[model samples]
Target: MAHNEKLALLIVLPSLLAGCTSAQMNMLTGKRNKTYNDVNAPWVGSTEEQLISKWGPPKKSYTLESGAKIISYEDMWGPISAYHVCVEKFMIEKGIVTKWGISNCPTRIKGSLPKDTPIPQPTL
Candidate 1:
């Protein structure tokens, strides 16, 4: 109604709309990632079949010389113009999960590696 109020809305509305568009774009492009803190604890000692049933297939996976399997899933957030990503990794040995880690996610799940530790890079 007031001139000042109208001016404020003109400035703020575009920024709000821009943020929504960014999020939507990320989702459509498959750039969005989701974390599962609740499932971390019970995952340890679970078989590969169990992990797949709960979290679905991983986006990428690796196998080490020791026969350990590393499975990873990533999640992304923020506006598509400047998005950030986080990855969760599950280590399975002898068909059972032994440990897991997360990278760049805000909340730390139990059994995650230290924050300073680099995220594991897949060799192949």
Candidate 2:
């Protein structure tokens, strides 16, 4: 191969492999999106009261400039080794949940990933 081609491959190969896709991340975190989505999909139209009833009062709540409300709940029972405590945030408009996001929330894996394990970040 030409020198420039080899250099390009060397740069692109690691870049492509370094970042984990959402699916891969879910697997590593022990969550299957299909099952999780099946269960959670209905929540999109649910009332805020229903959510508060099921989850109890959120750890944090706020209102946005657009008059939408946001509530956040944390799950401390998640896998403790590699992931941080799971945080769920929901956006409520007119008392209904419109959207949500979750981070670092994974089911309890039997073991933890090693601390300080090196992961290559993309060079951009």
Question: 40-86, model 2: which lDDT tens digit per residue?
Answer: 44567899999999989999999999999888888675355854676
Best by TM-score: 1
The residue-level lDDT of candidate 1 at 80 comes to 100
TM-score of 1: 0.54
Q: Give one digit per residue, the lDDT tens place, for model 1 in 1-124.
A: 9999999999998787677743364555554322244445457779999989977999999999999999988889668998878787889899998888766765533333333434333221
Off by over 4 Å in 1: 1-38, 108-124
Q: lDDT (CA) for every model shown?
A: 0.70, 0.67
